[model samples]
Target chain A: MNKQTIGFAGLSHLGIIYSAASAARGFSVVAFDPRTDLTADLAHGRFPVAEPGLDDLYREHSARLTYTSDASRLAHCQLVFVALDVTTNDSNQSDLGPLEKLLAEVTPQLAHGATLVIMSQLPPGYSRKLSAKLADNKLRDNQLFYQVETLVFGNAVDRAVHPERIIIGSDKVGADKVGSDKTGSDKPGEALPAHYAAYLKAFECPTVLMRYESAELCKIAINCFLVSSIATSNTLAEVCERIGADWREIVPALRLDQRIGTKAYLTPGLGIAGGNLERDLVTVQRLAEENGCDASVVTAWQRNSMYRKDWVLGRLFASGLLQNTEQTRIGVWGLAYKQDTHSTKNSPSLALLRALNAYSCQAYDPVAKIDAGQFPHVRVCDAAEEAAQDSDVLLVMTPWREFASAPLERLLPRMRGRKVIDPYGVLAEARCRQLGYQYERLGA
Target chain B: MLQHHRSPHSPLPRTVILGAGGFLSPVLQRNLQAHGATMMALGRSTIDLTKPGASAELAAHIQPDDAVVMAAGLTPDKGKDTATLMANLRMAEAVALALQHSRPAHFLYISSDAVYDARWSSLLNEESACEPSDLYALMHVAREKILGQACQQARIPFAIVRPCAIYGPGDTHNSYGPNRFLRSALNSRTIALFGAGQERRHHVFVDDVAELVRQCIGHASTGVINAVTGHAASFGEVAEMIAALAADNIMIDHLPQSAPVTHRHFDTRALALAFPSLQATELADGLRQSYAALQPASGLAALSSASPASQKPATKKEEAVCP
Candidate 1:
């Protein structure tokens, strides 16, 4: 019996969770990164980041997993994954230079006939460009693959282990048939080798095998659809706010339809908040300009997101809460992009804070890293109640569990003002109104 | 919880309709929709009711407080064939079994006026004796009994609607009296009548039938109702009304009849008693409306006013009935 060793390159957010999940599924896994400190932290059983249940899984499967900074340690692996999360600059531009530099350094030391799978999210033609470089070096053409990474920030560990489906961008036909859309590509250098095929079976999920460009484009297509829906909901939600109708009551009818199921992304929110969806939109527009495909819908989504980012400021202005800026005290409950974890890339609450740079603001996030250097006058409170203390108005920006479960009957008396503007609708509006706090939400 | 998810704001129920691609089926769907009802119309293309286990598949589509209209059936003029009879029987059984399994909030079966005995010349009402005259009538008569028994046992609130001869837009049957007369007036500028235009029968507008169905479903009714205009007209009067609404140059060709002249009249007193708000459309008004709705984009009523080929009248089977 031959034991297939799986290797992951770059121990970032995408790399750490997937490596730990593969080890938990009874596969011998090896992950390597050139950063010695990050590798040392993982080798000593300290997680490089925070994800729910990630540390426990790593402890249970630590005997089968290896962490190293040496590229030669990946030579014995049949499938070596380059699973780096591409970072964005301060201008929100996708910086692919780091991923390209890492891929160049990791592909050369691989053993003969070992699959070099690029698991990082790539633009449409990036997969083809990298595969062309691998073929130029007399490497076996069948060993190149680009697998799409579908990791949402908060649910990384669970999605890594129990994926809805796996998309392998190679022309390999496995023992079990892949998804219905998997047809053989007419292009060359798209087939997967026997070793990579057997190694991917450890995920125990339905696999989709297609060409490199198709796989790369499929990931963008899914995100574009999701962003369009979110943008549409926000657009209509603004109309509902002006009119007397409630978007929350109307959305359930749409969700019950078979075309849009109960799990549809129909919530009216502060627009597309994370880096992944925005990056995909930018990538789509770039590709569309080169290919001349119609991309007006993507432009509309980006414009709507920018328009929704100023919702908090608009509400405060309309309520006359920010009129006396020198005396008015504002409390912001959460600063993370969403409810969990410490990632703040393209966080809407941070955008609101930046817009309110002239006003005195107090904010709190239980776990998210706050850069005090960005705003000099704003105070970072340790507790959520401290932020809400002596406030003319309180803004519930993020929907953390503590914000929803807090005893508002006991806490509202501490605030100086009797107004709460909650966009998330996490708090009960009726009870808040009964408690004599004037509440304002997006829709009804 | 199911009601919470069905329709949040609309007090009207979500309705599921079978055999919903036909002419009357779509009009009924539109009529109910305008009243704020959420509906799903399934045709044979969606689920072949004759197929085995299709009943179970249909049962899964129903929800609490949802209305189900079984419009699935075959008309006699589509002809006296065993396939037509058997298909209608199977659809009746499948729909009944589905109702027994799901027990929809309201069950409505689109029965026909053909269930009345043709032997009696007097106007037939809901309480009239049902005597199947042929294989086609026999099919509806058997279906009525099966559905009546199945709905009773299943504890489903069921209503049956027996509509008379219907004429309106999208009448593919192009039946003889009003549909063919309008088509003839448009295509050839001529109205072809059978045997001195003397057959006396009841004609109901397609929209009226749809309105009756909508009202029945809304009332959550459990009884039989007839869809008809209390006033019956001779074929000659219907042709004159079409000719008058059409053009000055339209001609009427009185052709020799092959069969005996039949009089089928309906007493719609029960329809008025069931719903006092119901208004039966007049013959001249219904004929004019049907004529205005049927003129094609080719200007058949305007330019092709004298074409002789348009004079050939459509068969009576093309005369209107819904399956």
Candidate 2:
């Protein structure tokens, strides 16, 4: 067994996964969260997040993991990670209050030589500000590092266990500012604590070392690239609808090109939904506004995302199905932002539902629980077909696999109307069209 | 033939390959060899996977640190019956059973895009649901599951490559895409299609699939990837592409439409993310290379004379099928 004892403070999605993965990697881990109930549940193999292989990973390595709510429990560790999932507000601005409080509580209790790595989504200068504040507590500047956490919501366990690359932003005592024009090689990771370096080496991937600001901004940079791809796909998909072309047909040609590569965000969907990407875009726009830099592209992406979010609404208006509010009984399937996630923050389904609130709406989601009081106009159904029953129109909002594989014959008999507006193409258009229903999908 | 050969990179460990006589194996073996891999290419003549006790024989061949490629199976052209399905499952069973005994560093299983539920006409990725349409597709799905479970039990790094309508020279199956188009164009100076050939399907060059396998072996990449060009072309378009390189007087015929014109598209983000350096062969360029490979020393004359295989009449099932 590895002698290193790692500590994770702030046990949210990132902390739970990384701490479990650390324990699986043979390091004894102390998972500390402020919520006592969460820690108590985690001790019994009950994870708040529903990730595949998470329950089993925690169970298999239960002997090596310790779940605690006490901040003082972190003092016994050689390396500590501030693994809080940043909370964002309506404007996509991060509320760093929880992260700030946790750091304040955990910093004074950290072992003298222990390396404190911030593994949260941070703004460009947050790490440097933290380093400056912690200097008063006698925490050595070289001992502070910021590691980018690239864990997706649904696929966190696997990514946490086997990262593609480990990007660490070490504190270069008096390095250049956030956006320096100077060019130089990245700093070496030799300043990292031996235990911390050894823990990263176990992953067997490349370790990229840079200054605190770059590492802080790296997460945002990656998300911005993804947003750009999504914007590109969404824009072209709309064009495909106008012209006699299929965006799906063009995706392959683009993917084969080396410049575009295979994994480009080529799938057209209801714009940027989840909180993280939106947060990064808003941050970029804010940074540009404050720095007096031009961010026309970012502004365009934001506008495009807002426009695309109402894709289902656009189709509904075009069809004039919602013209007679009393006659039109709309069935909306999928409330989550995306499939396999319970979060409904900025969900396009909710956006569509809100637009149709004047009309009677029935909605169903496999996992996401809808508060009955939040939308008095909508009825929450137990099953997908239940939501479709007796409705004049059915809108398959989220492309859940269950929604895709649901038998079309079942929906054919239950629905009162023949119009099916599926933005994500969850159901087969050919099948729907053959069944005497007017089926419409994105990108022609 | 215009080709871009992969340069020598870091040499790979010993690789044990099944299905040596298949069209893709030889090309894959060559590519792996170019990358300095010591290959033990096993064919049915050496170890028939459908026979009993095949697992024991395979187990004895595998060693620690060797990358094993299980590409042996009955193609749809061979037979799409339950008998063929069972035989394919048996092949996978043999490989799975062998892996349980002798663990390799990495295990790769060759699957097909047929495993994906084709009813949903959206872009498919690795995460796409595996709802097989037919027994042939189901056979691949079953084999993948069997091998995946076995690899997991043995703690072996496992990957699955599902290629969409692979076509190139030396292809024996001759699925109703580029391969059959090229053969009909050469032998009869005619390219036949079903229903105006409007159903667009993605086709990856056999060499590109081989290159992907080489990279997977080199990097020890684990997870599922679809070996596709991401470019779906209509059968008419593909026929035109092939005929452009063939004789100018070649005739194009559209037969009666038998089935619905369903299109298949792919989201190959996982493929790009896994092998960023991999360059997929363009369909037009790939067809050109395939056409050149089919040419005899005397050029199209030898094939035009109608060999016994070429003399066989095209079956109704053969011309209508699109996979």
Candidate 3:
């Protein structure tokens, strides 16, 4: 650990969390970003985003960690990771321009023999193209590794530090690569160099080594599977609601079936909304279209997500809750995509607000990075109580804990109407109905 | 008597393998054996593919429920000369003649990526052209036609798997691409590439190809499906990767090209469509495993004596290790 220097070129979601985790694991971590403000803030352990336990990790590992805006700091590192979180546009299309530009800048500062790993979640074949662009350089293919980033937005810290398993996209370079390294042809001792071995040794977890494309696709495959599971749950959960069967009740059956397992994404909610899944779906669609192949399944997931996002709106209209919307004052409980994360890239709450822009709405988010002002008229309230006050119907979009403790029982008698729209089933439906408030939820 | 087990839940399909001593043969046998599925793997020693009515024994060997995996064929290196073309044709005819009598539930043909024209197009899939670039490809194409018809007439579901450059541990075929690239990375530490090494080609791990063939045993998927990962990497990309894995001290030497660069990429939509649950092993993992497995002195001997290399080399010895 003392011999190896782990360097990160981008200090965003992937960079900061990983560097801090690497530092905590007893390795010297040097994190860099082009933005001076971000780097300066990171140096003081002030992360911009709210990831659970991230700040604590940074504070604990700050002594061994160095935050820099200069790329040259990477020149001395034995293993340098290009960990930029690739941004996506409105249509969920990935804009890799920033990641490519960062790689171009990081390449020149790369120390001779330094193993450069692309730790970002880029599209399949992007790494091959990135490696191809550096063909003129003295870089070796084995050094150009792509470790698939499977960090969840809300739980980046724990997921970054202690991953379930590490999947590294790598290749064997040079002449001796054709056959197995153990084929009685070469010396038996550690054939892998000390520097490279040090990098692998630091992982401290079961690691899957794959080629660049497979590594890249594995990320999408995993996300796509999650999306499929979510879609299946949501689609069937909707059916369960109509047929008088609870999805939560059916979950145990699915979980007990060893094939689906207990950890399957069987929870029913307002479809898949995270940008990563959507971005990968778009990528698959684009890949299929370019190749003149069928991507109907991916397109179906996208369609299902869009349809499920409107579930709240659909229920409102079905229950005659949206009648006289010009005078209806709606209260939105949460706005951030999911719990404990400030990212609202494809938050269903924000989508509901946009759909309800025709009506008067009071929105309150416990930790909102999304500006509710985009809805062109919803009033952003200070607290959960204010949003719930004097509302015709209260819509619980995101399941923030603060909303659950928002004194809903006390505020129920004060509202103009008693309709409480909770898509996530955050509050007890029987208690709300017994308190003289009309209760609603998804999939019963 | 065959080697396999019987399970009440999901019975391992009784299987018959045609080319048991081919490149993908050993891995296929190992995987099937691990599943405890009954199988009969026939090689040249068990049955000569060149002889007339060589397939007559297939009827008696095959059971009604048995699936056959045809992995037997001469590779480009072995069949590069014109003298080997007749033997290749004779081998295909023998397999077809054998399948005529006894119809198995499934028949899988281990085809080649060389059947697609690299000059005319780069992106090859199940729908690509049938023009073969060399005699080895021509033989595979011809074999597919003959065997495909035989399966079709027998009302049997057959799969044609055309795998691109296959590289793995115990691989004897030391081609210039991944095979040669790996050898160059280890033996020389300085990888030499043809020209700028810009030619994009597909290289699937031998185990991955075996897994694809295994998928066909129980599956009813028919027609031509290229067993590609849709990850076509450049020769230079491969060189750079090896150079890095070997060490930072390694060098990449770009040499002049003697042959025209043929860019071969594949759209693996068919493979995806056929086997939705298959987790294909990635390239880096395969390379690392292969490298690690083949690291010790004479590491190739680690294979159980049942491996194809034990009886006959998977690929002819590469007299010239690298260019």
Every candidate's chain B TM-score:
0.86, 0.90, 0.86
- In the range B194-281, model 3's lDDT, one tens digit per residue, is 9999988777888888877776665545777787765678888877766666644778888889888778877543453354334556
Give the candidate number with the greatest TM-score: 2
The reply for model 1, stretches above 4 Å from the true place, is A171-191, B1-323
Clashing pairs for predicted structure model 1, backbone only: A171-A190, B173-B318, B175-B318, B175-B319
Arranged by lDDT with the best first, the candidates are 2, 1, 3
Please give the distance, in angstroms, between residue A153's alpha carbon in candidate 3 and its true position after superposition: 1.2
Candidate 3 lDDT (Cα, 0 to 1): 0.75
TM-score of 3: 0.56
lDDT of 2 by residue, B1-323 (tens): 01112222446878888887676787787787777678887878788989999999989989988889988787877778999999999999999999999998889889999999868646676777899999999999999999999999999988888989998766666568888888789888999999799988888899999998887887677888899875688999999888899866789898998888888987654553354335678889898888887787524334334543443221211111011
Clashes of each: 4, 2, 48
> Which model, 1 or 3, shows the larger lDDT?
1
Return whichever of 1 and 2 wins on lDDT.
2
Best by lDDT: 2
True contacts kept of 3: 0.00
